[model samples]
Target: MSYGLDAHTIKSLKKAQKNEITEHYIYLKLSSFKKNRQNSQILQQIAQDELYHHNALKKFTGTDIKPNIFKIYFYTFISVIFGITFGIKLMERGERNSEKLYGELGQKIEEFKKIANEEDRHEKELVGIIEEERLQFVGSMVLGLNDALVELTGTLAGLTFALKNTRLIALSGLITGIAASLSMSASEYLSARTEQDSSRALKSSIYTGVTYIITVVFLVLPYLLFSNYVLSLAVTIIVAIIIILVFNFYISVAKDLSFGQRFFEMAGISLGVAVISFIIGYLVRLFLGVDI
Candidate 1:
């Protein structure tokens, strides 16, 4: 059930967790100064990563990692929390610290130089930061939710072609939402576990699962409030459009895509999907004639 922990692995994990916790504290502290949606979301995301590192350390060592308990009164928190900003400033200041680290720092860590695989060495350095996995999964899951909100909302909207009863409408929505959420989450978890690449797996699962759930959940909301199937459908479609725009904007801004490119690309893709889903649903209705 347990394997002996390597000293180097232990050291790497400890440093990573310490860095994460310190970063978490900095974000929490930042909350005192500003209250923007972007800042809040970023801070929360960063906090999730820190917690994840702590959890990973626990899994590896079967011991509680208390960042606060490490040192009674030490200020190495600078590297943990401020290292990222420092790196950013270094680049901003137009000085390539890359030379110093690879040339000088690599020489200092002679053991690292002995490792045959340069890639492995880079990977180890990458893993030395604990907050990475957390940032990746959590952020991706949020995107998944956004996708659900847009797509499933569109589904129910298009489904208005079926029947007119509000009960049926709400019932349809309830069915879709619950089913989508459970199915998506389960599928995501399974897929993620099976994946070899941690970051890729997390991103795929979160994006797919969350989007699936959100789309289904919103699809049914109109039925709850309106008796007219057409009206519900119309509102759902409108909501879907709004959601799509928001989702597109989100990806664009987050990824630094050109506004015009993001707009047309997202619009084209979404419209195609919507059209296809609508066609499929309509054909099914015509062939089956609502017997089920």
Candidate 2:
């Protein structure tokens, strides 16, 4: 059954074989963490498919290959924190990138092409059937997260310039953040109720509120830890950028959106507002002769 592949083709097959094995391990581990019977079953099915691919490729190399231990743990951890859909989609992006390699190999070997087609078919089927709760309420989470980022970042930046005391700025920011979170949640609840059912509205508000509070806590942590106002402000801005980066990456993976564009837009707007607020605060402080 020798297809008489060249050295380069053989090497490529081995690399792909390793990737398949790695995904098999990752899917198996992720399935264990899922409480939902359907999701667990789907993951198990994917794992088996990956194992089959690994074995088929093993015939070419005439040797067994070990899975990547690092990737398995890394993606498993990502699934635990970010939800199953996000982790799976992120992994799928890797697989998509390898499609060109598959096509190249397929041109040389018919078996490789057949396998690539079958895998693509399976991917489409799996994607259509997947359902995750977190993804379902993503809009609500986005509303909360974006509002918190824009509003709190601007407010804190203004306070940082207006008040020189770290403790005082942090205290003021905390109080304002809590109050804004509650107001945002209530507004979201009302808006959702107007558009959807009461139950969904309530759930949406909860997601929004929880997300907002979490964002606020992260944004204010630097001020609480650092005594220097300028240093705290710098850390807080960095934290805000990181939050934007992480959230945009997750959304881009799960929803098939543009990561760079969304990330830069969100980050730019937040930071731009902060800069404007800082200037405004500085002018107000100077005009009022406030020395705090």
Candidate 3:
């Protein structure tokens, strides 16, 4: 499989290679950051995952691949808005190619289909991406749910730490979680409904709402598991870290990236959040002399 590749697989393989390179570059760029062992371990895992993806792709396509540094450079130079726009454009291109790839493959002989290993074509893929993007209109509710889930869980954990009563914590968690959910759901629904095609938005929003609620329940379960506030808080953080790591591994497996590389990337993000939040919380407590 070294030189000649089916046009569809070529495109898919190119995209995969380019994405791996981009993640690798991003990881390398963070080399200057002062990281602890846990964070370093995560990055290593993520990088390894990316490498595995790259290698598996090369094995399948048999094409000698090179890093697309120019694309990476362009991405780094772009403003945040333009960067997202660029990503959308790439997604558009990928959707078209994928649709073409899959659609053609659908009509081929079963033997050919087995070789191609895909069923959808370029136009279908393009439409799918478009629909996915547009459908997020209702997904505004989903995103709101996600935000509430993350922030509220973190909030409940922090509050429980500071105020060590289960009934009190339950009341606070209930008020905060419900309020956050309502506010988030309303905002999501309203924003999504504003779109021209609500079908996509509606489906996306519903899926999002369901998924986010599921994630929130999982995040909050530690509190129910342990009666002690401090223990529950600790358990919550551990569970979150485990979930995030597992998610990283699953994503890596899907992309053929090694778990190690994905772990590192996720670990870095988690560390950044934990450090910033801890500093803010610590400073507030110091100034206010609040007891936990």
Candidate 4:
């Protein structure tokens, strides 16, 4: 049976069909990366569902659409590095963006409504079943990353004026960051041990330590590369802002939270600390008669 789809409707349908096929490939590719048998099976089932959706849409469009290969590998690589839950949740957000259009199309053809509902079900089921190891240690990551950002940003800002040399600032920041990362990891391990399994506690500590170290590297890179102290300080702060933006975006999508509020709140706190620290550094330098 052929439905009367006008040019505009056909174009829309084709776009959706392309999305379906692309997602089908993405899910199919990501399913292989899951180590947990149950999670793997669930991903496989979702992939098959996507394939079914693609075939159904193809019937309407009358032209077989090729999947977007770039998206397939891109999402696959993301899943490999960021954990399957993050990648899948990000994809779910994409599906949700088109929900209203699907509803509109449904008014013309009932099949779209069914597809939309199925997509909703997929998202809900995914949220419930996803058990990635990385997600389990999110609290640890938050602890490490947040502490590093706040502490290091303040420390670097203070040092920027007090030390007033790019090389010296970078060295000081590295020493401080490394020491803090170890301390934070140890504290996390002890804290987690009190509440959970030893293995998980160890994993939490590792996550915290790794996250802190990575943040430190990025934040300190500007100081290492630039000769001008003021320029290095400016670049370091900008890098801190970027890190906050990217991290908050990942968490917002995976956890389904408000990105703007979290982003602004975090950015404000880090910059505020830096500003206050900068002032204190200047006052201390003036009072102590430090010449470097």
Candidate 5:
């Protein structure tokens, strides 16, 4: 069944076919990891749909295509580490160009339109129903992460100027960070207890504490590694911004939020507090006449 397609069109169709087959395998692999019967069934359905799309494209190209093995393994590893919802959503976002191509091709071919519509409607509905514990406690993670970024960044910046010694700054920041993380965890536990059961609340507090400590370790590492206090502080702020960028991007993709807005807002608040703390540190050092 020759559609009288040009070489270029056929090539593009083959690429799309490969993508569909790759995702079919990816979804199939991911479904096996799901313990929830409903979630597993949903993934299985999506995998079948992807397979159907691959065969549909193959008809136009009149050729066999291999699935991308690297993509299948990469997304599977990501889903295992980060949770299935995030990994799947990340993969779907990467397919936006393919979806656009389908839309363009749909104008010329009726079959492409049907495939495009199914991709847009059915798969999304299936993915939306997937439940994961990490996502359920995302708010706890955010609370811990945000507080650590703002409070610890400001504290470290203040210590950097006040101490003017890398070792001293790191020591002070570590103590402060550890103490703050414990306090935040306890507070979160109490707060969550009011809204949910004790077991879930405990889990929430653990997530909060672990996330806070992780952020603290990253922020303080620069001071430990670098001798120059100024450079250490500079690196710490850069690290803080990077943390914000990465976390916001994850949240944006997994939760379908606006990346730019959340990223800028969090970055602005954290850096602004750090700057204020730095000035305060200088003023306090000047008034106290401390020499280290």
Candidate 6:
């Protein structure tokens, strides 16, 4: 019962069918590994819905479609590395374009409309129920990442002009970054201990410290690789921007945030501080009569 669907419509329906089936398997795999009973049940329900949608489409198309194996592994790996909430939300974000397509097809087919509505309403509600520890400590991670970006970018910029040596700048940035990360972690642990358990507080601090150190490594890599301080400074700034872009994008998708505002605010502050610090470094070098 293709319902007299045109060739193009059949092709579109087949694509949608494939997506539903693939997602079904992905959700099934995720549910199987989930330790939380409630989360596992919710994921299984969503998977069942996806399978239902696939079967509905199969009735119309009169064909069977295999799930996308690569997508199955890719999303599962992402869910394992990143939190399940983030990974699933990211995958669902990609489905927005497909939702639009579903809307268009719904105008002609009643079944498409039902599928679109269920996808929009039910799956979202189910996905919202999933909770992960990493997401709960996102604030700690953000604090660490933001501080590292702003402080280290400025510190590196200032040192680049003042020291005039890439190796020296790298060594100075590494020392400063490590010290700051430790300080930030301790502060986070203390703060979290006021409101949460000792174990949770420890985890929060670890997240903050690890994020800060990783960011520090990325920003300092250019200085270690390049000979000229100015060139290394430029590359570090680029790396900083890229980090801001990626992190904000991940947050925006996972948390349903406005990406542009958070991104510009962060990047502006980091770079602005770097500029001011650069001037201060030059002034100090001139006035203090210090040579490196």
Report lDDT per candidate.
Answer: 0.52, 0.88, 0.52, 0.87, 0.92, 0.91
Least well predicted 10-residue stretch by lDDT in candidate 5: 121-130
Clash pairs, model 1 backbone: 144-210, 144-211, 145-210, 147-211, 148-211, 148-214, 148-215, 149-214, 149-215, 152-215
> TM-scores across all candidates?
0.45, 0.94, 0.44, 0.95, 0.96, 0.93
Regions of model 6 farther than 4 Å from truth: 104-110
Q: Clashing residue pairs in candidate 2, if any? A: none
Which candidate, 2 or 3, would have the higher TM-score against the true structure? 2
**Backbone clash count for every predicted candidate, in the order shown:** 10, 0, 34, 0, 0, 0
Kindly list the per-residue Cα lDDT of model 2 for residues 142-239, writing each as its tens digit: 99999999998999999988998889998999999999999999999999999899999999999999999999999999999999999999999999
lDDT per residue, candidate 6, 1-292, as tens digits?
Answer: 5587788878877888898999999999989878989889988998999999999889878889999999999999998887777778877876777688778878988878988898898556855787777778889989999999999999999998899999999999999999999999999999999999999999999999999999999999999999989999999999999999999988887778899999999999999999999999999999999898
Supply the global lDDT for candidate 1.
0.52
Instruction: Write one digit per residue (lDDT tens) for candidate 4, span 1-292.
Output: 4687677877877877888889988887787887778887888898888888888888888889998888788778877877788888877767754676778777877888888788888988989988867777777888888899999999999999999999999999999999999999999999999998999899999999999999999999999999999999999999999999999888887788899998999999999999999999999999999989
For residues 85-149, what per-residue lDDT tens digits would candidate 5 score against the true structure?
88999999877877888898899889989888988985478557888889999999999999999
What is candidate 1's lDDT per residue for 73-107, written digit by digit as tens?
23224324433332222221221222222233245
Model 4 has how many clashing residue pairs? 0
lDDT of 3 at 5: 50
Best by lDDT: 5
For candidate 5, report its TM-score.
0.96
What are the per-residue Cα lDDT tens digits for candidate 3 across 1-292?
A: 4434578667775676566555455434432231454544544454454555566555656665766777555544431322222333343343344344434544643433432342233223323322223233333533543364457555665566455665566667666765666555555556667873577555655555554555566667777777887777677667666766765543343233567865766555554554455456556666788875
Ranking by lDDT: 5, 6, 2, 4, 1, 3
Q: Candidate 1 vs candidate 4: which has greater lDDT?
A: 4
Worst 10 residues of 3 by lDDT: 79-88
